[model samples]
Target: MYEYIKNPALIHEGPPRSATSMLSKPRVPLILVHDGGGTSFSYHLLDRINRPLYGIENAKLHDGGWWDGGVPEMAAHYVSLLGKILPEGGDILLGGWSMGGLLSLEMAHQIALAAREAKSRETGESSESSGTSTPKTPIFRVLGMIFIDSIFPLRLAELVGPLPEEPIILSGEHSRTMKLKDKVDLNMTHARMMVRFWQVPRWRWRDEAVPVPPTILMRAKEFVNRNPADDQSFVDYTRDLRLLGWDDYDEEHGHFIRDLWEVNGHHFSIFDHKYLDDVTKKVRKAADKLDPPEF
Candidate 1:
């Protein structure tokens, strides 16, 4: 029942001047999560990927960010959202760019929890919900997870140095916009949100309690800064995730079948191109590893 929202800007059959072979293929369904910027529309690159990319931007499901409602509650709501959109028995892979990636992992955590709970409560007797009998377990589960240029571990960004404190004040070169101090303040606010997310006592890592999912992490290849430590630190931060049992990740790998093409944008540019062939090939490859592909 997971229905994908189709955004043409996200899908690329190929740029106007290019090939048609790629355009003719079937589009795969992608469940995309967006980074916080009040706009999920930014992730339109999925249109070009081999599969159809589904963008689930900030959930109006829980207005004030899930931190206030509790990550577990928010996480469960998201998992349910995935369920509502997908066709029954459909296997969907989860992935996100930046903060989106982090949440995907969290979704994995939520599923793992539900799976565990269902197992624990399995009684021979039938169960009833709202006075109606139903199956004893949750139905939705992810086939895999992919992370793109994502952030890892709380308080990790500080090690990378502060993000731009405020919006560039100059609209052009002369007009002033946001102040520098404002930018810093915003970063601080975001930091507090992270702290709130991790407020789940003993819940810092997903694998701590939940079974980790098959994970695909594609770390940034280019350096974000002149500081060599920044690059190394980012790697180190994610490396810790491996200890949770995700070591097979491809840091800079893309499909060999399709010529590697970038969407020409920020870190999450994987979707920018109209190259559905690339995504088709990659998803097929990934599907082979996890489960059989849908026709």
Candidate 2:
């Protein structure tokens, strides 16, 4: 049980951390960028899975949007928000679930460009013309990525939808009010968003170009969509990700957060079939890989 609330403006609580400094000393912090849709309370649940096992802390950007800024001007605001989550002058691993994962990839690309510019300025060499490798001024020493039931590029329809008025969820204490009609509408909405974002430019993060950091991706098994439940069929989700330049997209793992070594699924899967244990166990194992420096 990670103690959490829906919004930061909650009643008579306590002080909040400045965006720049939410981490603790001697312990590395994980920037957990959660997806936008409903209230961010779900991340409170996500927080529980992380802090206990890793002995590290994490925080969610309330009402976060993956586009770039907020929901409206996401593309522009994305990098700056990324700066906030990154370790200030330190190597901080990036983790994203659902839409947050896609945004993390985009931000990594931006950081790469910034490094290029800084090198050019320092050495008085024109990076564009020189065509030589310049020193990398990392946005953060992004080590590895943890993907929880996400591959945004493949599922465009889910990302472009405007923030839902009411949070759309498959499993929640509040799911009692959810109706079949809403699920149908959401499916249609997801289709349009994916289609529209199709033409949007894609950014690739290469292991050769940057630090070649390691990566981790988790996919849901039993959890299928209602409409095109078989939509992800025949898709070697890992290969598609490899094309995107990530080092690994492991599917040999289980789903849910409370398992012994299973990779967690999408945000909704957190509430599916007592799966949280499975998700947590996998993430812990993936995280443990960093313990004695085993890549």
lDDT of candidate 2 over 206-289, digit per residue (tens):
333343245566665433343554554322233234322232222211211221122434335653556656665665556544
Instruction: Compose the digit string of candidate 1's lDDT tens values, residues 1-295.
Output: 1123432123333224233234543333556565543234545533345454566654421122323353445455667776455535245667666666666767766665666555545543335334556653345567677665554445454454544433322222221344534433443345335533453223223444443556555543333343755545433454334321132222222221111222222343444554434544554455344443334
Q: Could you give me the TM-score of model 2 versus the true structure?
A: 0.51
Question: What range of 10 consecutive residues in model 2 has the weakest lDDT sum?
Answer: 54-63
Please give the distance, in angstroms, between residue 207's alpha carbon in candidate 1 and its true position after superposition.
14
The Cα error of candidate 2 at residue 25, in Å, is 9.4
Which residue ranges in model 2 land beyond 4 Å of their true spot? 1-27, 36-39, 47-76, 82-87, 125-138, 152-195, 198-208, 225-267, 271-273, 290-295
Q: State residue 56's C-alpha deviation in candidate 2, in Å.
A: 17
User: What TM-score goes with each of the models?
Assistant: 0.56, 0.51
Cα RMSD, model 2:
10.8
